[model samples]
Target: MKPLNPGEPRQVGRYRIIAEIGEGGMGRVVLGLAPDGRLVALKQLHAQFAHDPRFRERFRREVATSRLVSGAYTAAVMDADAEAETPWLASVFVTGPSLKEAVDAAGPLPVESVRLLASALAAALTEIHRAGLIHRDLKPSNIILTSDGPRVIDFGIARVAEDAQDLTGTGAIIGSPAFMSPEQAGTGQVTGASDVFALGAILVMAATGRGPFTGPTAPQTLYNVVHGTADLSDVPEEIRRLAEPCLAKDPARRPTPEQILNHLGPVPPGVAPWPPAVHARIRQQDAEVRSVLALPLPVWRPPPKKMAPRTKKILFGSLAAVVLLLVSGIVALGLSIAEYAKPEDPGVASLAVTEAVSPERLRLTDPCKVLAGRFVKESGTLKPESGSLHPARCKYTGLNGVTFNLQLGESVTVSGLERTDRTAEGLPLLRSTISGGCDSVVQLPAERRFGIVVSRSGKEGDPCKSADDMLTAALARLRTHEVDRAGDPASILPLDPCAVADPAVVGKNIANAESAPRTLRICEWQGGGNTLTVELNLGAYVADGSPVDLGNGVTGDLRGAGTTKCTVHWQHRPLPNREAEHVTVMMLGREGSGSSCDPAKEIAASIVPKLPKP
Candidate 1:
């Protein structure tokens, strides 16, 4: 069977498919519209898996278990067809991206975001376990940052032990290994605590760009997970303390889901009060069951009322005596129960809020000193050569170095080499900015700016073109170093390699011209550090003769023109200083414009070198 394409409209039962939202090894999930035009996410298991009778039975059990659970933080399932040829289930569609994707695209999320997310997800787990279900897979991918809060999804593998026939196979891994609980990885006995372990992993990932355990091989990673301690030195104290217990190697030592929820602080009353709507629905379904069960008609029989007068009198007298005794007993019992139910000395109840910690201060020594003497300051321009343009003034560790304090919507640039008598502090402390975009931030190392080369291209639209030769020389100064991980294969890119390739000059034809259809490629290079290069290829269908329109932005008419294949280039700053904010680079095409244009690179060069004097 063909997989569903994005934005292609179709229907399964009452659910109308809108578009493909995401996919994984299990199956494809589509953003669907119901008959009433409400949005939903429809997850369809692959036809191959649907053929397995055991899988179908497990899926049905999952549906029943989910129906029994209720929570605002969990995605509600609207409909499901486990018996279908290609079984599918539809749930309320959450708007934002997954935690992993968000962090990948925008660095780490903020502290507030992390706290709120933790509380919400823990509450969701509370509801899940309360309903007698355990969510086996609770990694970042299953968490959606919706408008209200983070919603946990994909309950397909949730198990109700009594109903489960071990459909996933004994000892088969169900969740992402990096986030899996020890019990889950070893025995496949998924309990609510598994989600707690996953939550701990999520917190680390939110604080750092990567997960807790990274290894070159899966076995090594698993071993590290099962035996090694999590490296959470980079995490803030408040968060680290709160999360440490969740990752306890011993399941017994781990906090329960309720305990985790309590640690998140209190939720206002009535937000998700008792007797949730799901419970009501369950009761209604039970009533329907009762009606079905009672449908079996019984043989009708008439009662005979032909008793002797004396016998009737005796029976009435006995009944009256019994009623008097029952009334007295009921009164006595009610009094005893009411006295016991009296509130016992209202126990002290106080709410504790999670603490907020400030950012850390980076220390420097004399060899790392940044000299203000090297900068060339003009009335409206600040020019920094290879050894100039230190951004801050600070004294620490018997040396004067540049102090870096970046705030939201603000940025500072550093240039210059710090040569130390010893090899320990030879490289420049500032390298590149570590950010996924405007909203996220990551940290980079400092040894990338030695032995510089600089070059400039004399192009009109190219801001750094005049200094192309010097810039190239500066680019040549960078050397690559590899940062290897153990279990996971994804690598972290560094700032040095970014300096080599001019992001502005990489794909000029595709992005500079209007109506130019081009394929953009971002390739990561291997060496001393991580490097990414972008390539743009023009397509034949794109009309080069006429102008095409690009979209709008902060500056008016962000529109571009022409069908020329313009390739834009950009390299990421490996790690941003504490105060350095993230930046977004957009590629636009216009008619008759030169091919080598990178919005981010152009902006960085034009604005960076000309920063105002402090």
Candidate 2:
């Protein structure tokens, strides 16, 4: 490969001139912006490689295989026209040093980070295998360590193992020698297991800052990788265990992706469910956003203020970072809260665990909060038509057995009640009102939405003499629920509507709340029939108006325990009778005296009653 003349346009089909990102005996990879404005690393085939019909066929197969493999951990194939003049291909431009560069500049990654990297890459290879393709070339140069996470790049040599007989024609060495699996070198075919073998080699490099199989020449490295054993003596126990399975001499002995995820450990309870891929993407985006934000604003700005090209790049990068941060923050905040919950105090709050009965048999004297942070009282359980009260069915299996699920809309419901129940201190286990389809219910713990089956058969004890004891039990339940629902990353961030009010109005309320500390402004808006939006100015509790760390901002939502005179109407309409009765109770404690507070209920006089009988 030779360098092109300066300012001379080099075209590969529709792709225009761009600087080269990498060059080798096979070809050169040019950096180009796609027609749609996506940065793509375009690999342009050198004349020598392109002229070989065998290589062209292999390259075409690589493009097809790459397109079939779609994963968050892998660099996505954006565009490729293999049949074109120069047979160009493009992938998402990952901006960061390669793994080789990182290791060379900063030394080997920490042990924990290395393990994380191995697990992530192992998981990515699992996807590649699932797609019926093998990344024959898994080398350090092809591994991109971007702000988001490690992305497996360069699928140029990737091929389906099943087609190896037809594609390879005769057994031939095709991939990097040091990372090649024994099967790849011998049979010219790489299976899902082959990637596992390569992953072990990569882990060895990440751990000791050197490849396990090394040689001054490619042939020597190939010889060692084909017959030699990896040195795990230097690898830490924690990571060595992970690498050992991948390094299994017999591919059948290696762990599958599902098995690998299981070995990652039990998922924390009460957090939003996320599969490994989404979970990884979330962390990657979060880190990338934080990194961009940490850069000085002026430093991130374009050199020429109004230059169209530079200005566009700056705007694109900045916008991308901000969006990533906002979304990640919302998700992380929700998951973190569920993951980290302090135990309830012993003196103030107590916990009680009980069996669940049929829909009409269960009972509740106190109000309860469900999945969406919504609250319901005991009276809400009765049906208007029959005037007959229904209970959320709770079953008994030996001892502790109950499953609780609560969804909100017209009324609350429990679905698919299982033999499971968990406890939480200060978490009100109120009554549930059945409405619409999906009739199922179970009680939930604080900072958690899932239920668990307690060990009721054990030594009989409430474990609720004090709030502290109840809290300890509740934390256990939270952790349990998190593991059960491990998938669906969207659940990580529950939707939260912002409180709309003038800053000046909020400022005035803050001043009053600080000085008088007793006066609170409660405003309500009718969200049409069966809905309302209540605004309670907690002043400082709304701190910077951020939804997270909402201190003392518990209004009529769950925390108020049906005591606050604030409620937000969800839908925009008037109630059928232009009225729905509700009450608000406020208590003012002496200075630093929340415990000394007294009850004061403010009931709405003569509001609309329940829906007219059918």
Candidate 3:
């Protein structure tokens, strides 16, 4: 989850948005707090879709049908507003990572966990099909894995079985490429059976990291969906027996959700459905929700009423007399207290030197910038490297490479560290020795801590002194160069990528183009058999690929993935901890469209100038 951006609304109907949860081609989902203290996952349609009357009518109908769906493994819809300017729907928020994230982090699930997942999803499909609706998009990303069980979510594309037309009426694909059933890829005649086929593909992904019919590209994958056989060689035998029948090309040959459930039987009692690592993620999300709820609510005040001339005069006269009396009382009180006031103890005064790091300041601190290479050059000719998977840590490389890590607003425990009677920027400094390296940490208020570690290749220099010097320099730079989102609202951190491109320009490249946010910082526009993607990212700026001058003092690295796709990457600015803010623009064209890079360059040239200057 990420904090809401600058232009994002704080409230949607009665639900107060806490943070963004996820985004997709259709809409974005956010964590919301309802009036009764219940947390919900609220999904709001993109403005482009809300403006279309046909899309709004379809969404209203789908929402009404989704409200009728209820089961042990499905997130129930709590509320909806299809008539609003930006239509939204709220559903019970389930705490867990999506199945895709779980698989990516922990590899494939074990046999027992896969069994439990298969059973729960089948039951969820049963409930959904019983509601007279077919879930058009049922991929791994739509399933949330909880400790108790798997809960299916994101019914944004579900519709009645009889409605066979696509949303755009131009035959654009609506579901994931690898997971779409053969019928959906070809004839577009979807039914309950299509979801079963998707379930089979998901089961294959859960047992193995790849889908059953996945190919080199999306078009190839779609073709495989229509013609190829299921690759069950990597799948465990136990799951293979159940998944084989579901993957039959003929829908009539596939088993119903009820049959699949009966075959798997009931989930075992008292046993956790997810693996230990997945359960740990679920617990983390649960704690995050609690912390968000504990924050103080924003105060709401009504607009002041205007008064007539006579009433204003009377009020001013009465306020003046009250101020005069209050001023006289304060003066008398100060005189009485001055005689009794005493100086504070020196020890007590010294203890108060440390400044508390406010939550607002911590949120805007870019971890990558805290220990930048320029600040650490005295120790060695260091260069910034790619950051770790954890967003709070950054790595540097040179004769003496170092890493800077931060743990903010969380309980921090330090062990094997010798306390020193020293301070860095008024905060207590601690030192520790490690294998071939030394570590130094600066302790802050509210359990926050920042550490710098220096590693020496040989026993030539004092690692502790290097660590300390780097930490001190970082602290000094942080005090002055901290990222200020309020002062620079135009920073990519707050701007929506979908709004960066001009609609007219986008249409000139691809007729009938429609935009959707693929993630918090990434957006995609698709039409006319072409796709353009814009992404705002933070990483090391590698000077690989061909350099193209994107006017306005900006240059980008252009690389081609294949004949049909090309991408351009450019660094926007240097961020904390050595990483740089960057932008990526990718273009994917139809099979015979020669040199996708031309169109990609054109689009990049148009949008790069619109971005905020470094």
Candidate 4:
């Protein structure tokens, strides 16, 4: 979990946001504390989809279906507002790592555990199907392995069974390709059987490291889902017997939840059900829940009870706790919290940014020395470029036309926990964004001057892996004090990318401009059409644009004048001194509606003079 970003609203309806829970393909999910002291998972749709009427209708339906679902094995919707600026839904926060995370971390569940999971899941599906809903996007990630049982969540694409079967009516297909049933793969009639197929696939994934339908791509995976038999090599024999029928290609041949539950028999009461690792994860979640509840608030009283033994015990405990709370005040609450707080991970460093070790000592050392490693050798020839004003930088234009740049400097980024990893040196390394091509930072000490950054510009393979590998090599070389310096080291790092455009200029093009520095060189403003991102020095030229003047010898290329996206780039730095250093301004319109390139050129013109002179 992380603090909310700048644009994210802290209050959604009756919920007060704490931090981000996680993000999915659709949008972000934030952890919110409800007024009644209950914690909730709040999902806010992305602006892209929020503007789509079809998506709004689907979200409306999802809220309705999720509210209808109720059981120990399913997350239920608690509140929602479909008419908000950005539609949102709030559900009870079920605490646990996703089933996928569990399997990935601990490997497959034991045979007995899988059997128990199967029985519980079948019963859950029976309830959902009974309510006339088909969980169209059932996958390992959507299943929460709670202490009591599995709880299904994120019914983002769920629709009533009686609704026509086009899962991707006007939007993209939603379900995991590997877990889809043949009917879903073909976009045909999807019923409860489809969920059964997904369950079978999920179990196979649980038993093995991979899904049953193996493929190199989504289309191929969908093909395998329709044609190939499940790869059940590692599944335990008895569990396989129950899972195989559910994986049958023909939905008609698949066993219903009732039949599967009957075959699996009754689950014994009082069983702790989940594996050790899963239980450990549950404990972590339990701690998080307690921490959320421990926030300062008005003293809450115990609600009327049903007068059972468990209720009496709970009441008695509450009375004692309340007495202690009244007598000891907030100190008692703090003590209660201290007892349940999770132990910190020893491998992770303190988030405090340490003082940066000045690269000034290595000024004479080639900045390219940072690139002296296996990944660099594989990437081909190193080319010197000065288009960007940043000091201590070099670039390599690979054979595939992908350019990789290494900047030895300090930078701030929108790094997420999902993308954070430790270098061999154990420095705090992180990806710039959950979704981005390449950016790695050895976060400097709070008072440090700079951190090492290895960035690649292109749509390529795993950027994080590439970045981490390069960072490792860079740190190892930096230790030797034998640097491979390149380009001019005397120069200071370039002006902040956002500084190139004044707020007034930004406001002129995008309303209510709020600047977010993605990196030292890339800045984004989210207001007009929700977002207008600017990446500086990404490339030299625009493929299709009419050259135009932005005053004082600066020239710009305007592209897509009448189209939905209008972009204008001004080459702020002159040629020969460096590769073209340009600033791009974009206006991302909704759907097929957008402004003319004239506005883009106007914004470009306004900022051209502010940029450093050629």
Candidate number with greatest TM-score: 3
Ten-residue stretch with the least lDDT total in model 4 = 345-354
Write down the TM-score for model 1. 0.44
lDDT tens digits by residue: candidate 4, 406-483: 776555443343446475465767666433577777655432335567776665666566667767666655654335
lDDT of 1 by residue, 59-101 (tens): 7887777777767888898888876667888888766667776
Candidate 3's residue-wise lDDT over 1-614, tens digit each? 87788876678787778888887766789998888879899999876678769779878987888999999999999999887778999999999999999999989999998888889989999999999988989999999998789999998888877763655344445688799998887755788999999999999999998999986444446656876678899999998998889999899999999999889887778998878999999999889878877776543333234457799799999999999998689787774322222312111111122322433244345555555444333344344455453333456554434443433322234775778787776767777665456666765553243333333333346667666766665555555423222323224544456766766778888878998755445789999999999987656777778999888999999999456889988888876777777889899998897778877888888877666557
Off by over 4 Å in 1: 1-9, 163-165, 267-614
Model 3, C-alpha of 153: deviation from truth (Å): 0.4
For candidate 1, the 10 contiguous residues with the lowest summed lDDT are: 352-361
lDDT of each: 0.48, 0.47, 0.73, 0.68
| Candidate 3 lDDT (Cα, 0 to 1) | 0.73
Question: TM-scores across all candidates?
Answer: 0.44, 0.43, 0.50, 0.49
On the 0 to 100 scale, the lDDT of residue 162 in model 3 is 74
Better of 2 and 4 by TM-score: 4
RMSD of 2: 29.5
How would you encode candidate 2's per-residue C-alpha lDDT over 1-614 as one tens digit per residue?
A: 12345765555444543455677545668766554545577887766457669878888988888888878679888878776656778888776666776777667777756756765686688788888887777888888775546789888777887775577556345677677887775553467777778888888888777887775434335545655577677787887888778877678898876677678764344433222433454456446534543443221222223347678799999999999998788787675322233322212111133211111111111011112121112111111121111111121221122112212111222343332242243333332122221222224422123332211112123211221222233333332211122111111011011112322332332233211111111233221111122222111121121121112222221223233232221111222333222222223223332321112111111110111111
lDDT of 1: 0.48
Count clashing pairs, candidate 2.
47
